[model samples]
Every structure is written in C-alpha cells, then in structure tokens.
Target: MVPAIESVGIGRLATCLREAGLLLLLALSVTVAAWLIRPEKMSLRAETAFYELELDAPLIAVADALVLYDTGSHLFLDTRTAGPGSFVTIPGALPVRVTTFDDDLYENRDFLYPEDPVVLFGDGNLPAVSDVAALLLERGFEEIMIMGGDLEAWRRTGGPLADHQAGEHE
Candidate 1:
C-alpha cells in the first residue's frame, strides 16, 4: 500500500513538470514568431534623419507670426491646453492638442490646407510644439513654422486673445 501511494505522488509531480515545460516552450515560440513577422517600413537611419530635420526646422518669431496673422495668408494653430478658467488663444487661431490631433481635422477646409503656411505655437513649451510640428511635417505639410515665443510674448506684442470657450463671441 505504501509503495502504491509513493508511485502516485511521483506520477503527479512528473505530470506537473511536463505541463509547465510545454507552456514555457509555447510562449517562447510565439515570441520568436512575432519578432520575425514584425513590419520593417521605418528604418533606424530614416527615423533618425526625420528627427534631425525636425529639430533643425526654422523658427518664426512672434513678430512675424503677427504679421502673417494680419495678412490672413497664414493659419495659426494654438497648441496650448486650457488651465482652470483660462483658455485664451490668438484671434482666428485653431486649437490643436498634440496628443489628440487627428487626420480628419486636417480634412476640414476651415482647419488646414496643405499648401497654406501654418504657424504652430504652445504656451512656451518647446517639446510640445516640436512634437506637433514633427507630426505635421510627417503628414507632408508644405510650409510649417514654430513660434519662437510663448503666450506671454503673444500678449506682449498686443496680439489679440479670444476666449476659446466663447464660441460665437470669438
């Protein structure tokens, strides 16, 4: 009787070990297959060159942006997020958030045109502005500009600010 009980215990241990080994092997196989089947459209060198160009892109001063605004030949994109009760933006400026920018927004005639000059500005946040500009460049926007200053500079230059929340009033 004692021998039979010992044999049963050993049999259960062996079965558990075999199951665990098979599971590990299956997981490893899946991982390797996924790696081998991954897409390869964007190469490392191409990605690096894109970032280099984005970093070295030309910057437009607040003065120049204002002039363009007055001329009505350029479109202004305000990438600033509203804080508390304040959502001030340049007059006629379209609001754009980097994280939420959609391709469909560009399809709207009122929002974007590929050939039109576009000035992208944030609340003095370089990284945020650069990210949005990079996305625009990737989407093949012809002429893109980054504002050299922040919202304060826009106000200092007497650039009109309209409350973003004020729909018809704007």
Candidate 2:
C-alpha cells in the first residue's frame, strides 16, 4: 500500500513538470514568432494622415520638440503676430512673424541655416504657421518641422515658456 501511494505521488509530480515545460516552450515560440514578423523598418515622421493641415512639412509632437529644445540643436520660431495681448513663447525661440517674413528672415538670416534643424509653432495661427513653413522651404531649408499644436499645447506638455512685453516681437 505504501509503495502504491509513493508511485502515485511521483506520477503527479512528473505530470506537473511536463505541463510547466510545455508552457515555457509555448511562450518561447510565441516570442520568437512575434520577433520574426516585426516590421523591418520604423518611420521617424509622425503619422499625419488624420491631420487637417496639408502642408509638406512634417509635424512633430510637443514632447519631441521639448527633446530638441533640450538638446539646443533646433531653432524654434514663433510665427504668431505680436499685438496688445501678452506674449509667451518657448525659451530661446525667435520671433519670425509671417507677415514680415522677408524682413524677419533678413534680420535673422545669420541664425537661419539650410542644414540646421528649425521648428515652427504659432498661437492658434495654423494658416500663418503653414505660410512660415513654406517660406522657410522656399529659402532651401532642408530640415523644417512644425510643432503639432499651439502655444497653449506646449505649455501643457511641461515645456518651459518665457514672457515678453506685448508687441515686443513686432
């Protein structure tokens, strides 16, 4: 009777070990299959298929813009018109009003370069934003990006902002 009980216990342990081994094998197989079928290449540009803007420039997220801002590798341009209202902008951003793009470009040409990265954003000024992007493209800028949302969006995304007197950019 004792031998019969020991045999039964050994049988249950072997069955449990077999099941656990099979489960581990199944998990490994799934992991390998997923890795084998993963996309060969990933696109860096943000998906803009759902966006309303039809401009040729690529749109970058505020988080990514923040990364660029941190690296200090990109020149940020503020495209909003300066007026009586209080103005806030990303730190180190230069004012380049679309209405005075030519003069602004001339004034800032030394800072503007075709090879360097440039990021443009506006305060609910989508049209002016596109205009600024186009103007920059025409001047042979190779890497011009537009921030996806307005200045308020930037503020909400933990981006640092600096205040300027009204019409100071004008």
Largest lDDT belongs to which candidate? Answer: 2
Q: Which pairs of residues have clashing backbones in candidate 1?
A: none
Best by TM-score: 2
Per-residue lDDT of model 1, residues 1-170, tens digit only: 45654555888999989999999999999977776775422233544433454442467878778888888888888766554454778877776667666733443456577777889888876677878778777777868888877888878876888776522123
Off by over 4 Å in 1: 1-56, 83-86, 103-109, 166-170
- Please, what is the TM-score per model? 0.59, 0.65
Candidate 1 global CA lDDT score: 0.71
Count of backbone collisions within predicted model 1: 0
Global lDDT of model 2:
0.78
The local lDDT score (0 to 100) that residue 163 gets in candidate 1 is 72
How far is 21's C-alpha from truth in model 1 (Å)? 87
